[model samples]
Target: MTEEGDQEEQTILTWARNYAKKHHWVLNPDEKKLGIVIRGLARNKQKYGEQYCPCRLRSGDKEKDAAIICPCIYHEEEVEKDGSCHCRLYFRKDALSE
Candidate 1:
């Protein structure tokens, strides 16, 4: 990745970490893997005008697809039930101990 891309990834990762911290959640601790997900988010933002989850297939319906945007509608529920978001990007800190 170019320096620009690396910078963008770092920015996004910082934002994600701050967001998780604000909500008492935690980002996946694997820096290499997190970078991949953060890059995917940046790519989605460039392509679709939103940071849709990279793990999900877009429906091509912008309105419907909005639900899958970063911090997606399903994430809270997924994290509550599964202990982590569907992409495993954000998870409960307690889950890390298990």
Candidate 2:
């Protein structure tokens, strides 16, 4: 990865970490998984100009696609019910022990 890519990924990771803190959640405990998700987010931000969810397909509609960006509209419910979001990025604190 180029230095630019590295920087972008770091920025995303920081944002994600802060977001998780605010929500009282945690990032995926697996470092490999966390890196993958961060890379995906960075790639999307570079390619489509938005941090689209790596685990989902985009509809090609900006307004509709906005819902799938990094902190997607579905994340809360997913975390609340499944312990983690679909992308496995954000997890409930207790979920890590399972």
Candidate 3:
């Protein structure tokens, strides 16, 4: 993935972390004094280059394309194509009041 893509993914993950914290969800197992909640998710990276999967990009299903595509590419979840959906693993930090 490109630098831009990595940055974007991090940004989204941050939001998810905050969202889970707001809902009092145990995103991470460890805890700290400041109580800065953290959320984590597994991301899939295929070994084969010729293989294709949603991990390359969200294609709205069709992830189980080929065995060469590797297994468990990004926590597979059905996201809406409405254009505004941040995705199931996504959460906007500003979604809740600070």
Candidate 4:
């Protein structure tokens, strides 16, 4: 990755960490998984102009696709029920055990 890409990934990682801290959540504990998700987010932001969830496909409609952006509309419910969001980026504390 170029320096620009590295910077972007770091920015996204910082944002994700702050966001998780605010909600009493944490990034996935596995460093490999966390890096993959963060890098995916940075790539999407650079290529698509939005940090769309790396785990989901875009529908090509900005309005419809907005729902899939990072910290997507489904994240809250997914965390509550599944212990983590679909992308496995945000995890409930207890979920880390499993």
TM-scores, all models, native as reference: 0.92, 0.97, 0.31, 0.97
Candidate 3 RMSD to the correct structure: 11.5
| Runs of candidate 4 exceeding 4 Å displacement | none
Q: lDDT of all the models against the reference?
A: 0.89, 0.97, 0.34, 0.95
**Tens digits of lDDT, candidate 4, 11-44:** 9999999999999999998999999999999999
RMSD of each: 1.2, 0.6, 11.5, 0.7
Q: What tens-digit string does per-residue lDDT give for candidate 2 at 11-90? A: 99999999999999999989999999999999999999999999999999999999999799999999999999999999
Badly placed stretches (over 4 Å) of model 2 are none
Better of 1 and 2 by lDDT: 2
Identify the superior model by TM-score, candidate 1 or candidate 3: 1
> Mind sharing the TM-score for model 4?
0.97
The ten-residue window of minimal lDDT in model 4 covers 89-98
TM-score of 3: 0.31
Per-residue error at 44 for model 2, in Å? Answer: 0.2
lDDT of 3 by residue, 40-62 (tens): 12223222223233334434354
